[model samples]
Target chain A: MENKENILEVRNLSINFKTYAGTVQAIRDISFDLKKGETLAIVGESGSGKSVTTRSIMGLNATNADVVDGSIEFDGQDILQLDEKELSKLRGSKIAEIFQDPMTSLDPTMKIGRQVAEPLMIHQGLSKEKAMAKALEMLKLVGITNAEERINDYPYQFSGGMRQRIVIAIALVNYPEILIADEPTTALDVTIQAKILELMKELQTKINTSIIFITHDLGVVAGMADRVAVMYAGKIVEYGTVDEIFYNPKHPYTWGLLGSMPTLDTNEDVLPSIPGTPPDLLDPPAGDAFAARNKYALKIDTIEQPPFFKVSDTHYAATWLLDDRAPKVTPPADIVKRQEHFNKTKQG
Target chain B: MLDKDAPKILEVKNLKQYFNVGRKDEVRAVDDITFNVHEGETFGLVGESGSGKTTTGRAISHLYEPTGGEIIFEGKDVSKLKTKKDEKEFRSDIQTIFQDPYASLNPRMKVKDIIAEGIDINNLAKDKADRDAQVEELLETVGLNKEHANRYPHEFSGGQRQRIGIARALAVKPKFIIADEPISALDVSIQAQVVNLLKDLQKKRKLTYLFIAHDLSMVKYISDRIGVMHYGRMLEIADADELYAHPLHDYTRSLLSAVPVPDPEFERQREIVDYDASVESDGKQRKLVEIAPNHYVRAADDEIQMYKDRLNS
Candidate 1:
C-alpha cells in the first residue's frame, strides 16, 4: 500500500459560491489523495461539499463559484491553475466524469454511438470512422446486448439501467486515468444498481482507473469503496480505509449515520438519527458544524474547531472527543454490534 | 406487529388500472392485484420503478379511476358511491402524500393555506381564526413551529417541505393515508426523522397507512405486513419478518438479495439473485396461494409444491 503512487492529490481545497442571499462556503479546507486504481468514495448528505470537491477536479464548477484556496495536483500539474484550454484537454481524455442522472447526462437527440464517439474525437483527435468503431466496442464492454445494432439508437431508446451503461461507456471510452462518478447509480433501482456497481468493479480492474465515487448511500459505499471519506456541512469529518470507517468509526456524525440505517438484524423500534438539519453554509458555523447535532459534543466543540486527530497511519477524524482530556463516551448500540460482528468475521 | 384480530380497513379485489386501452403502447400499470390493509397498521408495498406500486397507491387514493375491480373501504365499495355527498365524504376519509415534496407543494401558496385547504374543503373549521389556529397546530404536530406557517414552500428545506406535506395530509383527519415513497426523496439523516414522525403519529392518531416505497430495508422496518409487487402483479405478501426471513417468490428473493446492506463484510459476500422474467410470461395461470400460515406467494399449480418444499428445507 505504501509503494502505490498517488494519482490525484487535493490539498486545502476551499470553494465559495456567490448568490443573491450571500456567499455560501460550499467546500471548506480539506485534503485527500487518491491511490492509483483505487475507488475512493466521498459519502455525505446533499450540500455536504462532496459533489463540489469532485466537480472542482474536472474544472466544472459554476461561474459563480470562487476557488478561494488550495491546489489540485494531477500528473505533475496543478489542476486549479490550469488554463481553460489546458483543462479542456485534460478533461474526458484524462479525467472523465459520470453524472447522477443518465437521462439528462447524454444528449437525447444524438445517437448513442455519436455521444460516445464525440469525446474520443475531441480529446484524441480520432477519425470519425475510427471513433465510431471504438465507440461500438466500448458499448459492448459495458454489457449492452447487441451493441452493434443498439449503437445507432438514441439515448431515449435505452432503459434507465442501460442508459447509465452508455454514460459509463462514454466516460471510460478514452481510458482516462481518473473516473469521477457523482452518485452514478442513485437514480437506478437496487437490482439495476447492483449490476452497475458490479460492472464498475469489473471495468476498474480492466482499465486500472482511479475512481472518485460520490454518493450519500452508505450501503453503496460499503460495497464499492476501498477508502471512505465522510463529510458533513462542507467539511470532511472522518476518513479512513473502508474497514476502519465501518468497523471502528471515531466521529459522532459517522456513528449517527450508521445507526440511523436499519439492517436486517436491527430489532430496535426507534432509529438513533442525528437531530436537527445541517447548519446554513451561507453564514457558516462558528466552531464545529456538527456540534449542534452531536450528542457527545464537548464544551470546546462549541467554541473551537477540532483539528484532525490521527487514529492510525491511514485513519483520521476531526472531533473533540478524541482529545485526551475529553471523557470517553460509548457509541450507539448498533455501532458496537457492528464492531463485534466485524471482529467475529475477522476471527472466523 | 400486526394483530391477527384487527379489522380490515381497506381491501382491493382484483384491482386493475390500465392506460391507453386497446392501443399499441397500452400499459397495464396495476393488473389483477389483491391485498387488504388492517386498521391501524402500516402495510408497505415495495417494488422497483414501473412496478405498479405507485399506481396502486394512486388507485386507492382515487387519484385515478380504477379500470376494474372493487376497492372496499370499511365495508363500503369505493367505486359504488353514487351520491355527491358520499363521494365528498369518501374523499376526506383517505389522503395521499406524494413522493416529491418539491413538486407536490404549490410554490405560490403559504404553508398555512396549503394545510388549510383540506380543512376548508371539509368545513372542519368554524372561522378564519379557527382555520389559522388549526393550521398552526398541525404544523406543530409535524415538528414545525407556527412561524413556518407564513412562509412559502420554496423557503423551507426538503425535510421541512415533507413535514408540511404530512401536516396537510393530517389536516383532513383522514382515517387512512397513502404515502407513496414519502421518504425516498429525503436524505438519510432526515429520512429517519420523517419515519420516526410517521410512527409516532400513527400511535397517537391510530391512523392506517399504505406506505409505498422502493427501498426494501426501510419498507421492512416501517411495515407490519409487506407486499412485493412486480411488473403489474402482487408477487408476494406476508408478515414483514416472515417475508425477510423466508421469501418464497423468486422475484421477492431476488429483490431481497439485491439490497445492499451497510455492513461491508456482509456486502462483499452477498450474491445477487437474478429473477428470470421469462418464467412469468410462460402463459401458465397463476394466483397468490398461501404456502405457510399467513404467508402468500404467487405461483401456479405446479409451482406451489415446489415453493412449499423450498420453505420446509
Candidate 2:
C-alpha cells in the first residue's frame, strides 16, 4: 500500500538548540516520509520535539537552533541547500504552516483580508484587488459566511473558531503543496474542532495537498491522519498506518500513550498514566529515552538504543522487545481489550 | 457526618450571570442555570468556549454576584452574603483554582506568601511560624516539596505552578473547590499527573469539586456527574457513564459524537451529529426537564417527550 511518489522525505535529521544552560538535543536522528496528498501525523508528548522537527522543515526554528546533520528533501530537492531567496519562494507558495494560536500568529493591527492577500501578492505577484478577490473566495471555501463583508474586519472581531477559519484561509490561499497544521484545533471547542477538522479534510481532498499534522491528541490524529509517526525524545519510535499504530502498536511508549488517553467508550478508573515525566532533553539518555518510564522495558533498552525493527512492509517500530531473542511480551490488558472492541465495532 | 445520600453541599437555583446588563446588546453568560452538587462528589461542568462554563463556576464560587437566583452553600444563601464576616466565612469554605496558573499567581510574591494569603486573611494560622508550617504542609499535600515555598511562582514549571495553585486553594481547608479548566493548560503527560494528584487529594480530604473543562473524556474520568452547557444554557445533566452511553438530547448526542476517540477505525467511521438550536428549539421556551431517574434535559414540552421516546428507543 506504499506510494512511490514522495513529497517530503526526511532522513536522519538531527536538531539541537544552544540554550544558556547547555545544548538541548531537541531532535536526534529522526527520519520519516510524507507521500503526496497523504496526511501524516506526528504524535507525542510536549517535549518530544514534534514542533522542532516540523519547524525545521519550514526553516522556522529559533535562532539558537542548529541543524546538526541530515537532509530534508522536498519533491526531489533538498530544502536545506536552497538559498534564502530561493527558500522564501518555496516557503508560503509550496509549504505553508498554520500555528496553534491564531491570535498570536495574526497581526492585530491589520485587516483579515490583507493578511490573507499579502501571501498572494508576495508569491504570485497579484494586484491588491485580485489578491483580495481570491482571499474572499478562499474564506468562503473554508466555510466562513458573509465572507465579503467579514473579510474587512480585524482578527479580534471574529470569534475563536472564525479566527481559525481566517488562518486556514490564509494558509491555503497559495494552495501550498504541504500544510503543516500544529495543533490547529487545540484551542477550539469540540464542536468547532469537529467543524475545523471536517473543513481541513474537505480542503485536502479539493487541493490534493499533503499535510503534516502535529498534535499530542491521538484522537485528533485518528480522525485526520492516514499515516502516523509516534515520536519520543526526537525520534520516530513507531511509523505505520493509523490502523497499525492504534490497533497493532509495537512500542511500549505507544502503548503507554494509548492507555493514558481516556475515551468515551471506556469506564476504566485511573487512566494508566505513564509513571514518569518525559526525559529532560538537555541531558538526553544514552539509551531509549522512554526506558525509565517504560514498565515492560528490557535490560537492553537501558543499555542501548533500539533500531527500527520492521513489523511489516509499511510498519516499523524501535523497541528491544521486537528482537528475535527477546521474550514475548504482550501489550497492556486495556490496549488488548480496546483492540478487541475495535474489531467488534468494525465487524458490527 | 457524610452519608451515601448526603445532602447537597451546593445548590444553584435559577442562577443568572449577565454581562453588560440593561444594555442594547446584553450577553447572558449564565442564563437561569440550576444544578446541585452533592457532598464529596465531582460535578463536572463542560462546554465549548463562550458556553459560560467558566462563568457558572465563577458565579458559584461567589467571585461574581449572580444577577438572579440563589446559590445555597451549606444551607446559607451565599448570593446574598452582605456582611464582611459572612463573606469571609464563605471565602474560607469555598475557594477557587484559576485556569491560567501563570496569570493567577502573583509573580512578585514568594510561594509561601501566595499559599499563606488565604490562611492569613482567615486568621487560620497563629503567627508567622505557624503560617510557614501551614504553607509547608499544604505544599506537601499537593505533591510539592516544602522547599518550594521559599521560591517564587516564576521559578516553577506550569505543572508545578498549578500544584502551588492547588496548595493555595487548599490552604483555607475549603469544603468545596472550583477548579476551572485547571489541567487544560498543562501538557498531556503532566495533565495526567495533575489529575491523579487532584483525585488523590479529593479522596484524602473528602472535598467536593466543581470541575470545569471542555475535554469530555477527561471530565468523564474525573467527574461522577456532568452538566453539559451550550450558549449559556444547560443542555443535559446525568451520570458520566449514563450520559456517554445513552445521550438523549440532540445537542448532547452531537457533543458526544464530536469527541475524537483515540482509535483510528472508530474515528474514520464516526459520523458527526450537528444539532442546530434554532431548528431544534423552533422558537419555543425550553426548560430543564428531568427525563430519567437522575438525568435532566433542557427541552420544550414537546421536545421532552421526544427525548423520552429517543431514550426509550
Candidate 3:
C-alpha cells in the first residue's frame, strides 16, 4: 500500500468563515494524503469540517471562506493558488464531486442526457453526437436500466436512487483522477444505498480513481474506505487504516462514535453516547476541543492541545491518554469486544 | 421488555388512507393494515422511504381522517368521538414528535411558549406563574435548563431541538406518543443521545410509544415489538429479536439484509437480498397469519407451510 503514489496531499489546511457574529474556524490544521486508486473516508458529525476539507480539494469553498494557511497539492500543483479559470478546467476532467442530495444536485429544468453529456462536451470538446453517445454508455455503466430511453427524461422522472445514479454517471463520465463523494448515499434508502455502494466500488475498480468519501455513517465507512480519518470539532483527531480505526481506536471521541451505534446483534440496554454537544466554533476552545465531553480526560487535556502520537506506521491519534504519563483507561465494552475479535482473527 | 399478558393500548383494524380516491392518479398511502400496541411497550414501525410508516403514525394521531376501517383506543373507537370535549380528551391523550425539528418547531415562539402550548390549551396550569413553573419543570425533565426557555428554537442545536420537541409532547402528559423518524434528522453522535433520552423518559413516565424509523438497528434496540411495512402494506410483525433472527417474509428478509453492520468483516461479506414484488401480484389474496406463537407474516395459504418449514429447519 505504501508503494502506491500519493495522488493528493493536504498539509496543515485551516479554513475560517467570516460571519456576522464572528469568524468561525471551521477547519483546523488537518493533514492527510490519498493514495492512487485507494479510498480515504473522512468520517465526522455535522460541523466537524469533513465536508469543508473535501470541498477545499475541489476549490469549491464559499466566497466568505478564508483559507488561513496550508497547501492542497494535486499532482505537485497547489490547488489553493489556482485561478477560477484554471480550477474550472481541472474540475470535471481531473476532479469531480458528488453531493449528498440528488434531488437538488441536478438541474431540474435540464434533461438527463444533456446534463450528463454537457460535462463531456465542455471538458473534452466532444461533438454533440459523440458526447450523447458517451453519456448513454456512462448511464449504462452506472446500472441505469434502459439508458437509451431514459436519457431523454427530466430529473423528476427518475426516483431518488436513479437520480443518484445519474449523478454518479456525471461524475465518472470524464474518468476523473480523484472523485470526492460527500454523503453520496445518505439521502437514499438502505436497500438503495446498498446498490449505490456496490456501484461505487465497481466503478472505482474500472476507472482506478482515487476517492475521498465523506460521511457520518460508520457502517458505510467500514465497507467503502481503505483508510479512515475520524474528525471531531473541526480537527482530524485520529487517522489510520480502516481496521485500526474500527478495531483498535485510540481517541476517546472515536470510541464514543463507535459505541454509540447499535449493530444488528447489539443487545445492550443503553447506548454509550457522548454526553454533550460539540464546542462553539465561533469561540474556539484554547486546548483540546473534545476534553469537555471526554470521560477519561486528563488535566493537561483541558489546558493544552495534545500532539499526534504514532501508534503504528499507518496509525496516529491526538489524545493526552496516549501520553506516557497519562493513566491507562479502558474503552467501552463494545469496543473491547471488537478488539478481542480483532486479536483472535490476527492470531488464528 | 414486553409482557405476554399486557393489555392492548391502541388497536387498528383494516385502517386505510388513500389519496385521490376514485381518480386516475389515486394512490394508497396505507392499505388495510391491522396491528395492536401492547401497554407499556415500544412498538417500532420500520421501512424504506414511501413505505407509509409515517402515514400510519399520522393516522393513529388523527392527523388524517381514515378512508376506511377502525381505530380503537383504550376500548373506545376513535372515529366515534364526535363531541368537542371528547375530541379534546382524545387529542390530549395522544401526541406526536415530528421528524424535522427545524420545521416541526415554531421559530418565532419562545421555548417556554412552545413547551407550554399543550399545558395552556388543556388548562392544566392555574395562572401565568404556574404555567411558567410547569414550563421550567418540563425543560428540566428533557435535560434543558430554565434559562433555555427564554431562547428561540434557532438558538438550539439539532439534538437540543429534538429534546424540546419531546418536552412539548410530554407537556400534555399523554399516554401514548408517536415519534415519526425522530432521530433521522439528527447527526450520528446526537442520535444516540436522543434515543437514550427517549428510553429514559419512557421508563420514568410509564409511557407507551409508536416509534417509527428507517434505521433497523436502532429500531431493534429501542423497540420491544417490530413491524415491517412496504408499499403501504404491513409485511411482517414479531418480537424485535425474533424479527432480526428469523424474518419470515421475503421483503422482511431483504430489508434486514440491507442494513450495514459496523464490523468491516461482516460488511465485506454482506449480501443484499433483492425483493421481487411480482411474487405478490400473482392474484392470490393474502393476509397476516401467525407462523409462530406470536410472530405474524402477510402471506397466502400456500406460502404459510413453506414459511413454517423454513422456521423449523
The best candidate in terms of DockQ: 3
DockQ of 1: 0.82
TM-scores of the candidates in the order shown: 0.99, 0.95, 0.99
Candidate 1, B28-111: lDDT as tens digits: 999999999999999999999999998898888777888999899989888888999888888998999888999999999999
Candidate 1 lands at a TM-score of 0.99
Q: Rank the candidates by DockQ, best first.
A: 3, 1, 2
For all candidates, state DockQ relative to the true structure.
Answer: 0.82, 0.70, 0.84
Ten contiguous residues with the weakest lDDT in model 2 chain B: B1-10
lDDT of candidate 1 over A67-101, digit per residue (tens) = 99999999999999998999999999999999999
Angstrom error of the Cα, residue A179, model 2: value is 0.9
How does chain B of model 1 score on TM-score?
A: 0.98
Model 3, chain A: how large is the TM-score? 0.99
Residues A1-348, candidate 2: write the lDDT tens digits: 395588888989999899899999999999888998999999998788899998888887888998899999997788877777988898889999998998998999999999999999999999999999999999999988998888889999988888998899899999999999999999988988999999999999899999999999989999999999999888889999998889888999999888877787656556677776678889988788899999898888888999999999999999989999999987898888867876786799
C-alpha RMSD values across all candidates: 1.0, 2.3, 0.8
Candidate 2 docking quality: incorrect, acceptable, medium or high: medium
